[model samples]
Target: MTLGNWFALLVALVVAAEVVRALRHRAVRQERWRRFFRLRTTSWGLGILTFLLAVALAAPLLAPFDPNRQLDIVHLTNRPPSSTFLLGTDPLSRDVWSRLVYGTRVSLGIGALGALVAVALGDGLPFAALVVAIGLTSWFGTSRLVRAEVLSLRQRDFVVAARALGAGSSRVIVRHVLPNAAAPIIVSAALGVGNVLLLEAALSFLGIGVPPPDASWGNMIADGMPSIYTAPWSTFFPGLAISLVVMSLNGVADGVRDALDPREAP
Candidate 1:
């Protein structure tokens, strides 16, 4: 019905599609999944990320007030958190909780979408140009790591045998080289999600992000700056969200790196 509703619907559809695809195709290995959960840091990271994503996906259902509608401007302006207002009212009298809930879409959507664009295109593209830019810039290390792995894998016995057995270059590379080289790429991707979020916050703080009436954590922080002395919660919650998300992502990346390392035992 509304833009936020549409965005929430889009997120739900994408998540459902991915789940269906994974179930139907068995995209990830059972052992790897088991191993992933066994890692304490990654498991915790997964839990944290899952909670944040759930909040984002359920924004329409969970948000109590309209994120955009200003209310009680006279009586409720900048009220502190109470049973009536979970997080409090912003200077505009908009529910901070609602904005934070909706803001989840802006922050995580940008991070996830930007990461996908970066990994898929490896260069600039239309539509998500800013995301692409961030992704492309962040992918250099991943590219180099992948390249080195590819070079090393090309000389492996399996690759040599695949070639000798009449396998095409493309098939050999895709089946053998790329699979072997996927560890660092996956780790880098995990780390890149966190980086993108941080960058988005920075850009939004500078007044160049999903603009007003549409709450992004960065812009929320910016909006609360003048009221820092009077209402600290407005800025505190969003900054805390950013910090936690980034830390969780980094933890996941580290766990994945350790998990996928040849030296580590499953």
Candidate 2:
């Protein structure tokens, strides 16, 4: 009935949509995925990403306590999780879980958006000029290194064959070179998402995070630090959330790496 409740409900709906979409992909693209089905790593990557994402999204609806509520300011200060509050209250008496859920939304949104921005900054846009742009942006300060590497790769038989087949330089770069180079970039982007979450929490801890009544894990940590000697749960749960989210991203990236690179498999 409160804003936290509504926020949580919105999370639940998004999660349901994600689940449905994943299932639909499985059904419709079953054969397509199966061709690479030996790629258990891909499935694992997607599954773990889906799981962590669902957990973060559903935080509001599933969390028992009203995350933003200020409980008994006196007795609740520094108290650990109990029947009364599954995750202890902060210095301000707000529920740690609620703030955590809201924080999840902020962290995930920023990571996703930031990665997209990075990707879009590449020059492969509406025209061939964009390809030049992408090249410039991607190589930026590393131009000398990239040029040397590309020169070496250009001598490979595949590159020679592609050139003979009438593939233009841009085509070769897009089809051949980029694919080879993308492995590390994709891995780095996915793995870095957890770092965004930590940053969000830190911001909240400083009281500069999400505005009041919205709740945030960082805010919870900020509130709990003084009471850490009393109610460890205040900081513990949010810290745990940050750890788990980061670990999940690591797992997802590992799975993706294995799936994409067959040579890595035994």
Per-model C-alpha RMSD:
6.6, 8.4
| Pairs of residues at least 3 apart in sequence or in different chains that clash in candidate 1 | none
Instruction: Tell me the whole-model lDDT of each prediction, alpha carbons only.
Output: 0.75, 0.60
lDDT of 2 by residue, 64-173 (tens): 66666777777776556655555656787776666676666545654454324423654223222322333334333344545655777788898899999999999999
Measured with C-alpha atoms, the lDDT of residue 88 in candidate 2 is: 55
**For candidate 1, lDDT tens digit of each residue in 1-266?**
34564566456656654653453343256555544445566655665677678778698776778988889889988899987777888888888888998898778877876336333654324325656666667778778888888888888998999999999988997788776677788988888788888888888888876556678888888878888889998899999999889888887787677666554544
Q: How do the predictions measure up, each by TM-score?
A: 0.76, 0.65
Best-matching candidate per TM-score? 1
Residue 99, candidate 2: Cα error in Å is 2.0
Model 1 off-target regions past 4 Å?
1-30, 114-129, 155-168, 262-266
| Residue pairs in clash, model 2 | 67-98, 78-231, 91-223, 99-216, 123-130, 123-134, 205-218
lDDT of 1 at 46: 60
